[model samples]
Target: MTTDSLDLFADQPPTPPAPPDDAGAEAGDDGTLALDRYAERAYLAYAMSVVKSRALPQVEDGLKPVQRRILYAMSEMRLSSSAKHVKSARVVGDVIGKYHPHGDSSVYDAMVRVAQDFSLRYPLVDGQGNFGSRDGDSAAAMRYTECRLTPIAELLLAEIDRGTVDFIPNYDGAFEEPQLMPARLPFVLLNGASGIAVGMATEIPPHNMREVAEATCHLIRHPDAGLDDILAMLPAPDFPGGGQLISSPEAIRDAYASGRGSLRLRARWRIEELARAQWRVIVEELPHGV
Candidate 1:
């Protein structure tokens, strides 16, 4: 015999097995399954939960679950535009202890971001302390900060008092929170959103309220308007911070049409002529979310 014949299977296991009988088929019918199936189902559940309830913002209000909860908690405290700013710690505490149940730091961070003028195109919270910096500095401790809702924020919460949206019990069932804000406008497109979830991601740029309104009005008037026509009305993003969009109008239109592509933006600056022939370049507006 050759040396290959001495192999374990070669020595005694050359016979072909018969096809699976009825009993063999029945064996797989039990609740047990391949390990991958169990893992797949478990992972799907987690992904869906993250995508729907945590990561992505709701299209109707343009707010993520945490953001919505923060706003709801602030509204409950009557932190309206006309009201006094409450301590950031109190808001974080209430959010963690009630609706969010995540952690104080995260909740405070979200609130701080909402209050930051350099962050949100339309700031929701009006802060009264060292919230943060544009150069990537961290905000002060929550205890040192105070905040209340801005006038624009009131638009999202106005109808809540009138029962425009239904309230569901908080995490512990001790309180109630709105299912979704009854937004008077398309805040999602107005503010924009970016998030990464399991198997998916989204990054939408902010737009000027007036441009958005004009496009929206056109759509309302001519319901059959195509994406190109809409682009004609609002050619490119109008950052509130006022930057130059380097991307051509055609590129912007393509992005909007295909629901993908990047819009290049450059900060706008102006040269100031001073006395004695001295000149200084001053940055006027930065591309928001850059």
Candidate 2:
């Protein structure tokens, strides 16, 4: 009899196993992880990092990580209002090298914003060169600009070493920085803050220092004071641009009570007659965000 016929199919290798549902992910020692679960965890970690380390301003100091770092770096260099101003590049270098460990442009941009009068109700940095303009002009390069801390900034840093606040290690653990500046007053209310983080945001408009102080005093005297009583001392936001708020009193009251509301703002402008029959408009002040 003839030998059993060879089967070509029998010699063929078995089909390779199918890939996991998450084709992009590689197998780990633990087990296969769903793509969605991995993404969710990554997103959550990134969001928390931004909220805590970069985006939001601390309620205690009313300064974001970058801003606080710049101020602290300046203070360490003794760049006070009365001190001789130094090249902004120098400050930026120190900040990146010692504390912030970020891009030079970002650090310089934050410094410029702190010096811009139009950007803050009370500017915290004293810039000697073109910092910026309300018309959207950018500041000069760091090498060309010089800066120092404003007198008011001293209010935030003066007691830093008097045991008023806690200090923590910097990024490389080579230096120490304050956890939060010991501001005498609520700088958050005075300068106002606007930042959008991963899931939450803030849009606090600046208020008059006198009004805030009076309201604070009222609260201290009458701990149970009603919102109406507080409002009497601090009626509304006092923007640096000096625009008129057209929102009704009722609307303002409701906003404060509910912690959510919008205010209508009107720019202050006037007409100036030109040489020709045409007249030009001169804007005296702009709305808060403008």
RMSD of each: 13.0, 15.5
Q: Write the per-residue lDDT of candidate 1 for residues 166-189, one digit (tens) a residue.
A: 889987899888889999888888
In model 1, state the lDDT of residue 28: 58
lDDT of each: 0.78, 0.83
Instruction: Show the colliding residue pairs in model 1.
Output: none
Please list the residue runs of candidate 1 whose C-alpha ends up more than 4 Å from where it truly belongs after superposition.
Answer: 1-27, 274-278
The number of clashing residue pairs in each candidate reads 0, 0
TM-score of 1: 0.86
Please state the error at residue 79 of candidate 1 in Å.
Answer: 0.9
lDDT of 2 by residue, 1-290 (tens): 01122222111222333443554465466776676766766666655666667766888878998899999999999999899999999999999999987679878888998899898999999999999888889999999999999999998898798899999999879899988999988898899887666676667778899999898888889999999999998999888879999999999998888777788999999999988698999999899768
Candidate 2 Cα errors over 4 Å, as ranges: 1-41, 271-281
